[model samples]
Target chain A: MASEMNDKNDKRGRLENSISKAGNMSGQNQNNPSPGRRKVLKALAGLPVVGLLGLQVLRKTNYDNKHSLQRQLVDELGLSDLMSSVKPVTASEGETLRIGIAGFGVRGGQLAASLGFMEKSEFDKKSAAGSLDAHISQGNLNVAITGICDVFDLHAERGIAVAQHDIFTGGEIAKKHPVKRYMTFHDMLADKNIDAVIISTPDHHHAWMTTDAAKAGKHIYTEKAIIRREEEIEPLYKAVKSSNKVFQAGHQYPQNSVFQQAKEILDRGMLGDVSHLETTTNRNSEEGAWIRHLDSNGKPKPGDKKSIDWKQWLGNSSYVPFSTQRYYSWARYFDYDTGLYGQLFSHEYDAMNQLLGIGIPDTVVATGGQYYYTDFGDIPDVLHTNFEFPDKGYTLTYSANLTSSKFRPRSIYGKDAWMAVGGDLTVTPDGRSEKYGDMIKRGLVNPSAPMIEIKRGALTASAVDAVSSASTRYYEDRGLVSTNIGGRIWDVNHLHLKEWIDCIRNGGTPSANIEKAYEVGVTIAMADISYREKCRTKWDPVQRKIIRL
Target chain B: MVSINNQKWQTGILVALRFLIGWHLLYEGLFKLLHPDWSSLGFLAESKWILSGFAEWIISNSSVLNIVDALNTWGLIAIGLGLILSLFTRIAAFAGTGLLLLYYLMNPPFIGMGHAIPLEGNYLIVNKTLIEAVAMLLFAIFPAAHCYGLDSLINKRKKN
Candidate 1:
């Protein structure tokens, strides 16, 4: 502008002035006003850039529209509330309940830790390994571990150490309530110091212990299978129901956030007439086959005939020699448990029972034998059990492959869609569907891919582990039954215990109360009886007993 | 200081640079505006450099995170419009430089930092972010907006 004003006679100056005035929409010949058309052209020059960008964005997003399809399906299914389904963890109110732990072994150790009584050595080890999230996330359920009973002295000692020195919640509470070691569960139940009991003993002791605890005026949280034999189901159920005590079965699946999302998907009828649920456990490892006597490096784990009270460990099960194998891995023997049915399938059954409320299958047939790992245990290495709920119009099948670690998704086969549930939940629209038929045909939903995926990663809890072995990862991921609430991944087992404690302190029924536990017990018993007899076992609802045919 | 021998061409090239940078920022703002799920969480979460603690603090609080997100989304849009229309381009350029510098400091591609987020290309200490921030500073120095922009229309300049 300075040059143009000073040297209007120069041709270069004139050229620059004309270009600037025309293209840049500035003052032309300062004394002469610019034309309206020139000003309008310059003012609208930037619009083309924005307009081109908008068109390009539309074209790009259309090509990569998978997210839109997911959004559309989620919107259609009304599953936007799935994330918020995990209600925040409310602190257990009222008096802090005094609880006793019966048979504090491996599962018992986990239960104790989840309840916030993690021992110093164990806490340090987990903290060093960066795996103390279960305790770290669940601070205090307001329940104190007053007594710990175990037949094995080593385990009892470990439990005592855990309950004594483990003071994460409050040092005052820990000091005020000193933990005691009970040689027998009856002694612990007899003591008025104990108000509630966590039955984490072997499957054989669950029914009797739960019954005894209920009779002693104590609330019970029994670990599944809940019963080993068929006769104990009704008695335990009646014992729990007759008493005013709160009973909760330790099946974390039903209370899991993933299961909550799956339940929502089912409740919405998004799957559309689900007729089958395929439950599977594929493990190719020594540990999965109940070879628990040996350590990871194939060494015999601690506990001798002197340190362990073998007679009491045998309990009501028949007189057998005190073999360390039987003592450590009791789930293998028919005298102790139903093996795969009682161990892994019990979780599958309980989850199904809670989700579908399809309880006490009319007929159950179990097949397969101890094809491998036969030298040590009676339980089969490869077992396939089919449970038919004819009235409910669906069949639940469980395939346990101890020798093969193939990834067969635990899926519910629905007519319109299939929901594969695990640590994460995914719903895939079926290629041939009555409900989503038009969606599949219109290319809005790709049938091959999962339309809706809800991933609640428990990175701190269990998702990322140092042991990357397939079986180890699978089991760890399965064990991570996490309840994520407001970006906090809670240990599902702790939530399960929290629910029980809440029921005991407050006046509400837990998710896995007596009714739910009884249904699970019957189903598990049916599967076990069928497996043992090598025949079909039918449930007689009128008699409330399992009959073989 | 640029030579006065070829003033028109210098102004022309500088104006072109302004529009190009303005176009890039405008699209960035528009893309984030269109995607509802787009959040600064992932980027802040991967903050491994100087401002990592601040980044973590932002992420740990949702309210702070929301404020940062809103400021960034709208700030880019405002700066982008200003630069493209050559209206208050110097202030826009300065603000753009400051924002870009903050992003660079949050997750600089220095050796051994090893960012988990995938980038457009492998970068050392001097990445495109640093270069773009420098370019924005140059725009402020050259005053391209006043030479041929809406700023010139509002504040017409002439020599006596």
Candidate 2:
């Protein structure tokens, strides 16, 4: 009986030990897991939590990577107030046209100088030229110049130089006059006297300044590349729309007579069904990149700084240790400028979009990099992009490089004929063979069809005739066509700027208005995104959403 | 697992490919930067293409292009250096891929059809650049850097 009791005790001890071992194993698994059935079960059970944690980690990392710099900059600058609550201002009945400039850079300075000239010229033109100062008088115009809102010091210097040069040289002035230049753009806007402002800063600042100007009830004429980032565009449009002020985007090419003629020709189907459009810019120089050549004496002295506000110069970008590279060569950096796309490509894209009557590209793809110079620049030196519009049945290829001097033919190829303006328009007719001309024309009733083999480049008279005939046919068919095509093409910039001034005087939509500018900005922004992602990007015009490829 | 001869052949092919691609890019970049008279900007500006308006502006301002050229040269040098196991293998591979993509998109192989064979006119889908980029990607993916690089030195030290 004692032996049986001992056996039971031993069995009990064994069972307790097994339980302890399992418990110890589980504890170890809390620290580390061995390959076992229990461990496997634990791992399987924890998978959902692990996946959840992983997803959170991934989301945090991505957000940090993309927005960390922007967040830091925004926080540092205390730009929260600047972004929100844009108050609309109504044009006063007898308010003088108050104008403020966001950037006091080269472009800004020129604009300021031009304004000064305009102020002096207003009286003279009214007295002598009979040129209607109607836009200036009647409380329509007033001038208030603002210093560097966002740009490097060197860029500001260039602006100063340009202003000085304009004052000395003739630029939109009947007589040179001195204009009051302010230290800060905010001060200029806050004065409550300024009527309009011209934003001549880099691409990023254009939207912000324009929005602010509109909020301040100031008319605006912003340079090309209305805005760089996609998100900023809508708010700008809204600000402009809400404030019933004249808004003009600088797209000088459309104003050009040549482009106008080309548009007319395209409308008439003179070049046949346009299938492909290719454009390229391969500038290869330091000057071409718009890097201001800075003086050896680093940052300007305090006295000089007074003349050119340094603090205002380092506007929205990171407050880096002052370097001439940042100031003179701002375009080289992606932070300040959109490089070629915003500065140069914007004009071309806008013109093409206008000519083709396309709103925004359905797909955009870009590829390039800063491969050549070891300079302090972040923007790419070479860029090749394509905007595909499936709805329009066409694609626009844009290429720009700093390296090669290779200039390829930039023309639109159509189904019937290829039209290369500045050169002859070549029209290769369909179904016109040497031997088989009549063979395929079985039962054709029209025998008097003109049999012209390669009609030499259209003469002025012939062009006029062609335009009239095409217009007649178009009218009969209920199509949009031009009857006039022989006049010389005008300078698009001259015409565009004139239109803006005219719109200010006589209420009407500027040639390159808000909607068109937005289209151009969205397309270019999509291209930049596509380049970064190495895939196609699409822009929904109606929704104004950029779909990453 | 692979034979010594096969390894040698693979290494040889890779080296040849690297040299060709690296040299081509390096040469093109150098040629542009060195020749002042021959400017990409001027050519582009003068071209009868769709974006000539902007091309003219870019051509007029070559500072941006100069920066681009400098980057291209360095990128090529880096690719060459990486391929030869000098330094930064992954960086070099990434740059090469980037450069190839840019070139391919700027002027696609299949620009205009109906002139000749569909893909014959200016259409170079599988060009030297695409091939090089692919090779670089492969090298980056595998442990090719260890075969003849500082990676091997680090591995040896660790083993010791």
Candidate 3:
């Protein structure tokens, strides 16, 4: 730290010397303007009046040219307010909420074990090489898991084991209050003991389960891409609203710290008038592309299919030949998921929405097709979306490639400065601001010199790190969870779950509620439709539905 | 240095310098004013100088920005014409110097602040802006329009 300060001081000295040297050579310093030069400036200031009078005579020309310059720059640039703050709703101490786990998939497993059900030290034993140790926080939630449900017995058993503290790990485990395993979501919902149900199932199952849970008078936390079809949206929304249950969408990016800071940055206008924003989600490797892993023998776990209720797992999707790959890697298929739109693009969209609050786009044009990872899925592996909100005078461009892990950190561009919003928010002012005139005149701020880079989080820039490739780690670095809290790591998922619990107790909605998800749902649906139909899509505010353009 | 033989040459050189700089400024202003798409945004945005914050502020706010853009576009034309035709040459020269000073300050060719732009000539603190500003200062101090330019024509008419 001391050395860095010294380096800064040295650079400052050199800059000061350079500028002064230039001033001396110019025969005048900033302290004094030559007498004749000063006199000329006084006379020239009157030219504004003359120009104004001339403008009045050429009113048509003035009017025509008025928007031509300023408007074009802003429009071409797509500037808008980016950082808008939303206060997170916290829970108050009340009745111990009985929660039910649904789906028991990758997302469900993570959520259940992560909610203080699985011990951090025990979970750390299963961590991949170089992964940080999870934090052990006591006095977190006073909630109880009453029931667990999943079509797959393996997932349901695992979720139940974690919730009931039945899982055996390397360390000594303690017994916790048992949670009953429900073979069906309906059975779980039927139990009056379960006050809330966290539906982390496949994309297709989200709508029905959520609506069912809501109708059953249970608070809901459903995963992203909340509904696949347009038909499912209204019913689910009505169900949640009519039942007056707190419905939290599983778009957890809002819980991240960088997004929260982004709101503050936009509020401060530190980046100047934001014009454009670009976000990219890139992933490489077969595993990264939602390919299911095999057991130690490099084969599907023995009798995996036999343990799962295949008919129930298929849900509303058309039935086909039973395959373990289809059940495990359901994300890669269109019948169950919108592929990139549901899995990745939804994340980017919601994160931007959280920061800018631009909501739905005025128009969206989807591009790209199944480029890489083409063998398995009908969905596009590489997708690009250009969302234009003309009234707001900004454009949002989202592009993702599953073939390459080189992700471009999301950024907001302003007239004066541009900022990168990712795991850590970095704000760098545009070099051309007139505020730097004196420094430039002195040659202190070299035109070709590297910018004064400012960063908040330890993550240098949004680059793909193989070890940190897990979605949870990405969210953690992005401020969804605590990277390290006194040597213990915390997950934002836990925080999000805690928030929902708190809100449930206090009779409020979580930060990411149903209403915001509905808006995002429309946009995501439009993106998918636009991609598949090969057309532009428009959102009709009056109709509250997507209109194909 | 102002001997009878050298006086005419000096006056002629000064007048030529005045005309050349004036023409450049005038053309720049007129071209910008005529081109509807022309904006100072890029220049301001691309500014790598010390006053970058001020330049950014100017571009960020639309109202202040429009005024600045208009003032700059018209100011250049006014100063150019004033110098070339010898109408208020003193004020024009001073205005021209001030403008150059602003440009120089915004993108100084200092040791550390080497602009990414490819400069035509080697400069040590004294670039084109400085040279033009110094020349304009000289024009302000010595009114030479009486010798050849329109100011002299006006002076002769006044005498008549």
Q: List, residue by residue over A182-204, the lDDT tens digit for candidate 1.
A: 88889998899899999999988
* Each model's lDDT: 0.79, 0.55, 0.69
The CAPRI-style docking tier of model 1 reads incorrect
**Which candidate gets the maximum DockQ versus the true structure?**
1
What's the CA error at residue A416 for candidate 2, in Å? Answer: 1.8
* Tens-digit per-residue lDDT, A1-549, candidate 3: 999999999976764454323322332344658744543443343344345434653785667567454344334333332223434433336666788988777777667665656634545553332222232332346666778898777777777766875333213243456689998889998998888998898899999999888889999998888988777888888888888778888777666555665677677665667679887777776666787745546687433557878888887789887787777777888889988788877777778787778888999999998876777758778889999999988999988888886757777888766777765666555577554344446553433542233233222111122234455454544445442222223455766777787777777777778878887788888888899899999989898788888
Query: Model 3, stretches more than 4 Å misplaced?
Result: A1-92, A119-134, A166-175, A293-297, A301-305, A434-489, B1-160
Worst 10 residues of 3 chain A by lDDT: A457-466
Best by lDDT: 1
lDDT of 1: 0.79
Better of 2 and 3 by TM-score: 3
**Candidate 3 chain B, poorest ten consecutive residues by summed lDDT:** B144-153
Judged by whole-model lDDT over C-alpha atoms, candidate 2 comes out at 0.55
The Cα error of candidate 1 at residue A284, in Å, is: 2.6
Tens-place lDDT digits, model 3, residues B36-56:
657676677557667887886
